[model samples]
Target chain A: MAKELTPQEMLRIDLTPPNKDWMDIPTVIKPGIYCYPAKPEKVEIVGMPNPHVWSPLDDDWGLPEDWKETFLEGMRERLNKHRSFKIFMDICVRCGACADKCHFFLGSGDPKNMPVARAELIRSVYRGEFTKAGKILGRLAGGRKITEDVLKEIWYYMFQCTECRRCSLFCPYGIDTAEVTIIGRELINLFGLNINWIQEPVANCYETGNHLGLLPHTFKQNIEFMCMDIEDFVGVTIEPPFNKKGAEILFVTPSGDVFADPGIYTLMGYLLLFEHIGLDYTWSTYASEGGNFGFFTSLDMAQRLNAKIYAEAKRLGVKWILGGECGHMWRVVHQYMNTFNGPPEFLEEPVNPLTGTKFENAKSAKMIHISEFTADLIKHGKLKLNPKRNDHLKVTYHDSCNPSRGMGMFEEPRYIINNVCNNFYEMPENTIREQTFCCGSGAGLNAGENMELRLRGGLPRANAVKYVHERFGVNMLSCVCAIDRAVLPASMEYWVPDVNVCGVSELVGNALIMEGEHDRPTDLRGEEIPGFAKAEGEEEVTEDV
Target chain B: MGRNLHKGLREILVHKKGPIVEKWRELIHKSYPPETAQFLKREKDRFSNPIGSSIEDSIWPLFDQLIGEADPSTTKKLLDNLVRVRAVQDFTPASAVQIIFALKQIVRKEVLPAAQKKGLLREYLEFESEIDRFGLLAFDVFMECRERVWEIKRNDLLKRPYLLAGGMCPSYMMKRGIKHLEKLKKEITQH
Candidate 1:
């Protein structure tokens, strides 16, 4: 600078890391990466503890006077209560098998985003406070006392994880890193440190029985709007029942499908499929939402929100429940719901009334995913099908993380896709099925402000889709999760502009030939089928004659 | 404008392409943490290690484009492919585009001695200026990619207005926050 250095010298960049331990490297809270902190009113509405206004960027988080005690006691209680938590904390052999398995690590290239380092953020504290050796030998044993910076680092990286369990799939010891993140989040919520994107949905689900905070009438009207679209597009009029007693099945879907585009098309598919099959199902605005955003907050909140479904089912006297296409909702239903809210003796085991197929796997939870139900219908040849209507689309399936890893219902959605669409291709093997990448916006991280994080975390999944789009010409990314329908479209638009995202049932709606229906010339979204324009032109010419 | 100068520059660049690209790739890998850099350098698969594979795939073509006529469209396509990935990662605009400038340092170190021996130092300086221009172009591409990210984010918010605080739903307007609901309702209906 003294001699006015040349631009070449000024442009020099040294990217080497400072020679400091990772523990000493303070976490820098950046905007556009982390979600906004939860509003105190939302926390208060849900009866969570320590409601306060705090910022992630602030030096002081305005923790309660007894925050350390509260946090440590919360950790202690969780460790004692959950044997998996205690075992995960106690397990050793820090093998690096799971280091490269995380999409966030792959996309962002942040070592802390690696599942091992992420778990260590909490595991270090667990060792420091709980284990005797860590207490005696401090940093030598890879343990550190909890500090404000440590707490901040924990909150930062824990939310960075989508809890997709992809890392856990690769853990040689089968250590569930998602469970660590879940417990980490639970402790963070003990001090009211949740992000608004998650807390608002949890509060909304608690208050109005849905994450979108949709009122019952507004919810019904939204669906009626879809029904009207079905009438105008598909030439069908079917009045869907709501809150009616003695219905054989009570259908629950994520409110995202009712509110968001492309997801609404999936909802319309459910309606038409049910109408065609003439199944006795009722929609309950009380138990309207199938998604449990509270699962992102804490186990108790998850169970609290999930209680509505079983309560509504018992009240409506429904025999069993049919869940719509969703990601985390299935994780809750399959893994935790029965343990949290079950032994549902009042409700009978879920059996496909149309196909006479008993869902023995869902015997306890008594809730069958829509894909399983629809696949059984196609298997029994119970629905009129025309795969030619979807000729315009070269489809590839993305297995939503929860259903593939948590529920192992891989073949059902694939079976349905093969039956409904003529042209189908699979993405790369490692990126599908049990090892499927996240949509990067799951676990309540799909907020507007955190778009950069979402995009970075979405790279691995989008990279695979880009491969298929380039090699096999895949135009439609069909998935079974409503969050995938809501979020994957944005990722697709950003990474692979040639591909579009939709739900599996939307393809079904496009291909289903309803009885006594008028001549259908368009897909479910009212886009004209590729070969239908000539037929419509012929019709117009005949009419003129 | 002299044909000999262009030929001499091309010869030096092609002769030294291996060391230059290897050093440039090392600098790019250094942008990440030590452990992550090790993993990115070790993994060779494109799908499993997309960021590393992308950097490897783009740098060689980019080097070739730099040595050749430097077609703006082809350069932009290659730059966009690389910068697009970096724009979304944890990178400042300067840090993101700095990788492009690191190539100049590599060329100067690797090609300068050969050019000096051949009395083409002035031509090599011109080539360095070309790298400066490419670096500036990289900055433009980074900004464009970032703007596209913001546009995608804006579209997401407009598409899902319910995610907005105090949105259209009555229940969303908790604790006397109903003033914006009508406006939000209009926005939703318009959408």
Candidate 2:
């Protein structure tokens, strides 16, 4: 018989963070980690190796004869290019103020995981190799030599860290441990030893359109399935436009949302809402995933992944793309993409085709969040919502980190939740809104092996949420990010057992007004929201917000 | 038994206290430009009030304790001042290439060994060869230390107080370095 899956055991094997530290590490491992079962392997999946994992160095996985020269040159380049690196190198007071902050340290009880000590792993070597005191008065003076062993330890320890940057917040000088991890990863990549797991997803993203390796046809099939789900779940033949040329708005979502549960539910809400509103929108299988794992790996990979959006949008000749709720996707678009990809000439500045109000010079492409769009429609009296349809469960919204911190998307989702749900309680401030914690599985560490770390990492968020669930009787955890749907459920199932996770759209789908022949009387227990009939006056359009 | 020693070593570093802190105004003046430093010092009461004392007053006890505890073998205090002179022989060059050069010297020779003897070195140097191979140089020291840390025998190393003491060593000590008596005192006692 197959061994029974204990929460701890399954979490260790599935989540990719090193397993040895999970039980003993000082950090309290939250139940939120290990959100999914590890995919069973039959024949090992073979992927093409990208020869360009390293830049300005030899491509081999081992040190070449000129390794020292390569290493020095790489260090000099990093020092010259990033002021953050220089500040990091110069400013660590090693006061150990950041020691208690790392979840890995708390979970593993390994002193090496302590942020200050972890930094010293690099700082000591940098001092020993680059400066005068380091050369002669080595260990006593604070200098440490970088040997082959040091490199391997760096690979092992640095990779274990999630690059959360929480440590940086408390740090007096703002030393980003994530930067150190990136530099370490860059060095290891120089050696060509990017293990098969992470590299495979990156490779798949390059070959197929998504990290999950779903081809365009498969992607289209999933979208069609979501439309079918909308028909079944909410009584409407909600036809979603896929790959339609010259649509007013091109809707792009993470492909995972199309294939998964609550995410698919959110997608269904969008389809039904769009159909009811008579809005022109299309879903692109080409730009399927808004959540880019490439941003986590390298700057170049990030650029490559983002470059696809413009390519597909231009091909479709759409005006202003609408991005789905994803953490890093919003971060990349808001922080980097608008500047990186220019002259969105393929899409004109979004004009309220209804209001004729042009949103020019929008910081983020005039792309509207679905939550904001839905809430706006509600505010304009476009949809008649029965909030009592969602009265069965008390729901609370968990802010996706990128939208909360990356873009100031605090209000939109909450607006939808308040308008649609009969009862909604706010998660404690420490765990919600701008200070919201990650789902413990964002940034593609959602694999089975890293689940324990995810749980451990997500403890702070889980604990805060659990307090409300225990005291306030909150039953649902709602968020906008698809990955939150994927990861937070597992976390909630384990740690905060009182709550079930749902999308803001799932609630909207539950309460959405399906327009009828005439304005009908609204009832709490038994009537469907008015269903959508074709809108009149398409000939002489008037847009009023 | 060895693991117990390792555990003991960790305790030493974890428990080690640094110098009793003194002279915050002087130290603040050293890191920041005069205007910023003066403003910070003026606003020192604002920071220290909730925490109990001015950063200048608060940090001194810790600094002085670390300085007082530093091994006399390596660091020598001046007759009239709290400034401890680290002997620049065998490890650090007498003429520094840069300010960090002096730090590299003090860390590799005096600070690291004191840490090592007390079992604190394990955190900084996991392998025996890390101590051996990265024989006290700047970038190369980091390089060698990196190599040494990966050595298999590093698994067997003990955690000690000297290693813990290293944790108390400020980031400044590894950079431009203990230019003043108060900084020296803080560094000595903090561990």
Candidate 3:
């Protein structure tokens, strides 16, 4: 059952700002709007502060005895440590350019979900405590004390943000809301408060080297299981090397690829592509997950989980790392990995063996996104592609936020998609590339109780997809993010029913003509490939769309 | 009781149609942020003010469709653009469809005085059922939209139960289930 918000609340068209102070406008902490709390044990495992039973929906979340002091102190430390925090705090002109750009604000119509307003949630607190104007002229200076209402508002709106940074792209000062939210969330986590969706994965990634907490044997068996699918469907025997010593490259992918359905197909695509080129890479159970869920919470957690990739690569004696197609993983590995983990002096810069092209951007880090690798291979005419195999799919590409905005590797994915799929249509120019809307559930906010919020926040993305789907007869929404793979399917189902969601690599697997493969009568999902059934001398039924 | 309630309901639906439509549109328009709402509240042009246009398209036709005749297709066609926007909004099924019933409230306030004055209780009662029927139809559209929401979720789950199926710890069992489904799909397609 959907929780009800009055039409006046959701769609009130009044233009005037309330005469009352913002904090004076009462905050209703709605159920199914916020995530469940992290278990105390999980908080303990991560050694995060304020480990205790609590709920965001409750009036009194279990907090430290001096939670206010702790929060202010933590804010002070973060402000001193990171200059961006101080600058972002002081520099907001609140021009409102970034307001309508947010998918959450556009979808839910919650004014605070707007980037400027969301930033103001934290900025207000900063104004009250840190700034002189805020201290003296509190409410007038947009300063609100860190009261329980403000704290609850912080939890509600901060988690609501996907940290997609679409707002930053439009900001006159390039003020990244993700950085603000990241610091804001980290400050919140000082109370040992984290949502289970984020904390559980962070805990699991810490303990099991992956988010799903797959045991070493279970991890190995899962990869082997997908290989069997390849053998059965494609008739290609792919013995993907697992922790093989002295491999040329260490391939790290999000464990969602190995565990989930559409993502598993993408994982299969990686294996087939690797085997096709006789890629010198090994899959490490230790460095299995490329997605750093800790990234959603704090930089320290991201650093801890990301440490596995370089450690395993060093141990395996691999030259460089070839990252799988994932969203925030690329954001982390490309931007934050080197800074947090270190200069991996052991691994050489990523090189395409066929084209002998060195990835100069990844020279210091020595890691390249799989799209970059695949596009280079395709450009050099390395792998034989049969694009017509994907003709059944009138496809549209969803640019995952982090990679498109964070790394700006915009062309690489489209290049691969165009090469692999024939009937590809770009989602509207404004919605695609840098100005992309989040799938509404990035940053580990994909839990079920919050499904209504997720669906609402996802409307802009879904609406854009609907335009392409209705116009181009687009049936598939493809992206490079595992979170998108996990969440966009639900968004598509809710908004645009006929369209399906998949990873870009899943398209690659379908179109790829494997060496010594059984005529892929079906795509990796076992659905009949459009024209393949008719060609197989079966009843010439209308091809499944 | 039923006769009295029906008469009371009808008095509003027929006599107060104008105010009812105005109030309903006002509520829908108010759904946007204050700035957007202020412009949308006044903007009369359909092109410049699509929200205004949508209201004109959905509400006026909706009133005629409900009060004039039982043309479901024409009514649906008229309301589809407007309701679909609401359907995707961050609304509960109740709130999303509740806008449909705001007319009934306006009908009560506007038509009640006239019905009592004219002693047209019987005639007024007839309009009551008519608007109820429209409310039912509005519910039908809302439910269908909601059903599609759930259907999309169910269909996605059906497409790949593997999301929940995995981490259940029996690796071979999940594989067998996948293999079984693949074979079933293959057989169905073959047929």
**Comparison by TM-score, 2 against 3, better one:** 3
DockQ of model 3 vs. true complex: 0.18
lDDT of 1 by residue, A1-545 (tens): 01355888667555666546778776777777899999999999999988999888888898888888888999999998999999988884689899999999999998889999999999899889888988989788889888888899999998899999999998888999999999999999999999999999899889999888888888887788778778877889989999999999999999988877778889989999999999999999999899999999999999999999999999999999999999999999999999899978899999999878999998888999999999999999998999999989999999999999999989999999999999999999999999899999899998889988888899999999999999999999999888888888878888898899999999999889987677677777777888864563365343345
- What TM-score do all the candidates reach, one by one? 0.94, 0.61, 0.85
Model 3, stretches more than 4 Å misplaced?
A1-21, A534-545, B1-26, B32-95, B103-132, B143-191
TM-score of chain B of each: 0.82, 0.23, 0.63
What is the TM-score of candidate 3?
0.85
Interface RMSD of each: 4.2, 24.0, 5.6
True-structure RMSD for candidate 1: 4.6
In terms of lDDT, the poorest run of 10 residues in model 2 chain A is A34-43
TM-score of 2: 0.61
Error of 1 at A527 (Å): 1.8
